[model samples]
Target: MRSIVIIGGGIAGAATALAAAKAGLSPVVFEAHPASGEDIGAFLTLAPNGFAALRELGVADAVAAAAFPMTELSVLARTGEVVASRPTSDSFTLRRAELCRVLQTEAIGRGIPLHHGKRLVTVREDEDGVTAEFADGESVRGDLLVGADGLRSAVRGLLDDSVVPRYAGQRVFYGHTAKAAPSEPGRMVMVRGSSVAFGYTVSPARETYWFGRTHGDELSPAEMAAPGWRDHLVELLRDDATPAAEIVAATAEPLLVTNTWDLPAVPRWRTGRVVLVGDAAHAASPATGQGASMAVEDAIVLAKALRDTANPLEVYERLRRPRAEANVAASARMTAGATDTVPRVGSARRPADGAVERMLAWDAVLED
Candidate 1:
């Protein structure tokens, strides 16, 4: 049996381990976090493509139970007028922590060993296998090494020194609130105006998740205080006449801020017996909303490639590179279109309509 060592225990790493196990490969996962469920935020959207991959890995139902199915996505102008209403058909908004729990449970059930606090520091590959050196003075060897380690991937650095992360010049604030009974669930609302965008999504448990983004370098410590930053977002959304005013007004605490970043286009993603997957291979800006979906797809496709061929390096690169590259290009386009200021909202029409569907419709299960 081929033994595989997967780095990182995020959604991508967890899914990769599950896929490897189902393919009859012995897979062990190493996570920097001390536990499986840690550092994940309030909500994330899992489109049809990601759900399909989860179903193939036998954990779709578990994840679905933790999510609220979304029926429609409405894009609105600053004045609260709907510009476009796209039928979601199949999508869910769930807590990132809950999704991680479901994937981790399935991975553990498969008897896949997961080691926490095993931060990867270096990787060395050869014709026979690959070896991963961890920060804790521990090392592991396997027939193949998969880097699901995320955007700042040590494996990616080992593979290519030219790859670097670039800031997308946007900062995001995210938080969750209890859902009111009269509130509609399973609807994703996006309000875009000026240089700001606010997204609202409700989960099955009646919890509403909110995220607001704006182009900026960084927020000072004083700017992050409750009254300053919180009030700033309130004013931004209020100026746009967003419908969730009561929800935003009720929050007394400051929202958590995250800086959006992505990698510039890289020429290659594989080296020797070591291969990169998920954000480690192609990190996308949050504007595209394809980060999680791409990661899930990467896990499924990489496992299939490894299972179908004896030349792990060649087959993995041949089958995975094209798909990852296409996703990277699509994400770059979406990010550029959304962030660019074109005066008239109609200029942004093409991107807001079909970008999501095009990403969710990709069939990563099919081999090239």
Candidate 2:
């Protein structure tokens, strides 16, 4: 099997395509969108663990250089009084679209074929190989098939129909301020209230990124797409003492909203010649800020497993499932904790260790 077909053109698929090429296989990446993530995507945090994985992939330096590394992160109340603080090191923030663009560029630079507008519709696997049929009616055959598609994956359903994505309690609203927030390198702030939580950070580009998550019912499509959504968000957090409302008011960028979702332990991750990766296999809520990091790690580990073993799917699942599942649970707890958004009372002066460090301090290398 010298050929592999990867579904999805996001982080996981891009990374996988690059790794597959490096492993001396022909890898083709298919994306459902007409163009690469040009108009969509929010900000993402890359912890040290994510950086380490990028380093192994030989793109860490470039990425770190292009991103804003956070120097300190503090957990505070709506009034902005600190309850806990963590000195963040080796953690960076970048636009999700930029990250995907960089990874896609890097993959293209390495001579990988990435096709856009190919929506996967059906997946068929026989003893000989597997084929992925796309919406355009074109089908691609390969020795191995990897479903690195996002949460709602058609390929995933083919592997196990029982695996489905569920909505978490809250939704995320993200945007960039029209005027940049203060340029503070390595500065990260998260404030929680009893019902709503908000976070704001600056990218290396000096653009201010902010997200607000509130525990509430699903919004109607009209409300979600309304031109007043930004104002609606501002009003949602008006009582909170955080800068979220200010950020929302100042943002000229298009407001983006997403209903956060996650999956429980998948009944299975692989079947026959097909296997799942990234969110397709196990998606964690963004509450822990580990979703993207986990995706990157999955790409690297999956590549290594494919290169080293005869049963690469089994090896990949064995090594990745436990950690990925644990992270999913941690994310759930973090989200639940946000439910009680009452910012803690008093000033927390001393820097405290955060689970972020322990979670970020991971060994992602695939041992020989």
Candidate 3:
């Protein structure tokens, strides 16, 4: 049996471990966090492809229990008129921390060995296998190494130094409202402004998950986290004449400001026995809402590739790269269109439904 060593215990890492176990690989995971990933903060929507990947990994129901069903995406203009309504497939909205917690729990139940506080500092591969050296003076060797790390991946550096994360000139602040938002539980409401945009949804219990984004240079580390930032953010959008001001005012607390980033097609995703997955290989702006789903798909497709192919790394890259690249482009396009101007309800057409359906359509990737 060929052993697999997977780095980073976020969504991609956890799902990879489960899929590897299903392939009878019994891969071990190394997480930089102390114990769990329930602290990533913010929230996300799991698209249809994400749900399909979760179901394949055998944890869809568990994740669903912690998430709120989201079926429709209603795009509105600054004047509170609906521009378009798009139907979604089997989607759910939940806190990012909650999603990580459940993926960890399900991985643990499957007997996948996960080591916390194992921040990788160096990676070396020889003729036969690869060794991962962690910050704690511990090291492990495996026949192959998989990089499920995030955007600033140390493992990606080991693969090639060319793929740098590029900022998209936008930053977003995400938080949960202390009071229930007026948004519908089963729907997502988005209102676009000239320089900024806001989208929000309600949980099963009426709590709200909301995010606001604006185009600007990257914020300083201090300003990204300074106290009362939530209030400042509310003030910035107070004149939008939407529920954005109210939502920000009611948010419990402020989380970090995130500079939107995505990588152009990388020069390399695999080197020797080491390969990259998820954000490490392809980072997309949150505007896409397909990052997690693509990551999960990478895990499933990777596990299957390992199970059925002699050259698993090459096969995994061949099968997954095109799909990931397509989404990256789509995300850039959508984010650009959404921010072109204050979207008006009656004047413009929304993104083509066919384009969205193409992105959401993934039976080909999931078929046995």
| CA lDDT, every model vs. true structure | 0.72, 0.75, 0.78
In model 2, the worst 10-residue window by lDDT is 342-351
Put down candidate 1 lDDT per residue, 295-327, tens digits, no spaces: 886776677766665565566666556666665
lDDT at 201, model 3: 83
* Candidate 3 residue pairs in clash (backbone atoms < 3 Å): none
Candidate number of the best lDDT? 3
Which predicted model would earn the best TM-score? 3
- Estimate the TM-score for candidate 1: 0.86
Mind giving the per-residue lDDT tens digits that candidate 3 earns over 1-368?
A: 27999998999899888888887897999998887754466788887768877887789999999888887788767666788797765888888878888998898888898888899999999889999999899999998899998888989987777778987767888887657776667778887654567888887688888888887788888878778878777777776767778888887675657778898677788877898999999888777688888888888888877777777778778867887887777666665565633321110122455432322233323222
TM-score of each: 0.86, 0.88, 0.90
Count clashes in each candidate, considering only residues at least 3 apart in sequence or on different chains: 0, 6, 0
The lowest-lDDT stretch of 10 consecutive residues in candidate 1 is: 340-349
Candidate 1 wrongly placed segments (more than 4 Å): 179-183, 218-227, 338-368
Q: Residue 204: error of model 2 in Å?
A: 4.4
